[model samples]
Target: MSNQDSEPEIDNSDLEGNSRSQSSFGDAIEDQEDELGSSESGEQKSVTSDSSEDEEQNEIIRTGAMIQQSKGRKINKNERITPPFITKYELARVIGTRALQISKNSPIYVDPKDSIDPITIAEQEFNENKIPFIIRRYLPNGNFEDWELQELERLD
Candidate 1:
């Protein structure tokens, strides 16, 4: 094979087009600068140092005011603190964990009575709200609220 076959061909028209595009891009930037009031020294007129400092102070004051307002606000009692009821997934997790503890000879909260099954005893303890466990429900903002097992309404 020849060297020409191995090497990629450069089109002169493509090179000319690229050079024209580059020049046009530079021209567009210059036009934008001109429209934005660029001085003869190529310096753009922006907010003065004193004005910028005043803006920063105003921003800080606004932020402080917002924080103060938030602090002064009282929590509404009508707002649901904990979930209305325990979710099936949460109940399953709690039951599974309690059952495991029971299997490992951990003290059960409720009397097993005739039922010797660990899961059955765990369910009874959960129904009677005998478990002293807190469920940490997390919010989308990474904040979490610890709700006691007794605090949540149980569904049959």
Candidate 2:
């Protein structure tokens, strides 16, 4: 009764998770010259739980920088066999809006033909538009025909 009552009633699960998440690779860290428990003189500290945020804030990936890729996964039917590949910087530059701001109805409109593919329209939009904007295809992951970067193909 004495030891149990005296013990702190803190749950450390969340604290442990927070500590473990920060140890993720490729995170941004700004160092300070102040003593322990001291705040920076004129800098606002930024903090968050998302691991990917670290790469965006600090320096961008230069040439020959290491990038994380899924290594041991076997080729599965669910996975996209031929997904579009663009440079990271090029993708960022082309997509004026982030994934959040892109709307499903924004691109890939109905075609004049009886049956048309969405990917063709998407490809069309991406190729024709002078000002780069986010072009998201609504088609499921594997079948790119439903969602494409080109405007019109044989089906279109």
Candidate 3:
């Protein structure tokens, strides 16, 4: 086939349709305003009380007053939130007190040179960059900061 036969045919109606509405922008705008005014002036009937009352009664009570908060990343049971690596300051605190304690009421026996405390090792690893570990403690002490050399908190 020749190039002329290959070319797509344009619809003649589209060209005529566009030409029909080819009025000037100002004329088109003025025509729209005139149509609006004619519709408004055509009817002077006042709104009936019954129609207005029904509209007010039929008002939809939408339960959409709640603030739409942006969604965050979802957490699944298969997923876990890893805590930020402990810093040097945090490590020292855990090793010297929390990890060292054998009993809450009893005094702690801690020897940094030969200590097998998981918390101490974890803390040291976190702060000093020793090695990654999976630590497990049956009883976790929650009183390291309570009685430390730092004396950070004042208990009255």
TM-scores, each model vs. reference: 0.47, 0.19, 0.18
Residue-level lDDT tens digits of model 1 in 75-148: 23364354567777778878887788789998877779999899999999988888766555544433344455
Query: In angstroms, what RMSD does candidate 2 have relative to the true structure?
Result: 16.0
Q: Give the TM-score of candidate 1.
A: 0.47
**Pairs in clash, predicted candidate 3:** none
Candidate 1 — what's its lDDT? 0.61
Which ten contiguous residues of candidate 3 have the minimum total lDDT? 137-146
Candidate 2 global TM-score: 0.19
65-153 per-residue lDDT for model 2 (tens digits)? 22332222223335544345444543443443322223444533234244344444444444554223322322322222111223212
Give the Cα error of residue 148 in candidate 2, in Å.
20
N/CA/C clash count, model 1: 0
lDDT of each prediction vs. the true structure?
0.61, 0.35, 0.37
lDDT for model 3? 0.37
If candidate 1 were superposed on the true structure by all CA atoms, what would the RMSD be? Answer: 18.0
Worst 10 residues of 1 by lDDT: 57-66
Clash pairs of candidate 1? none
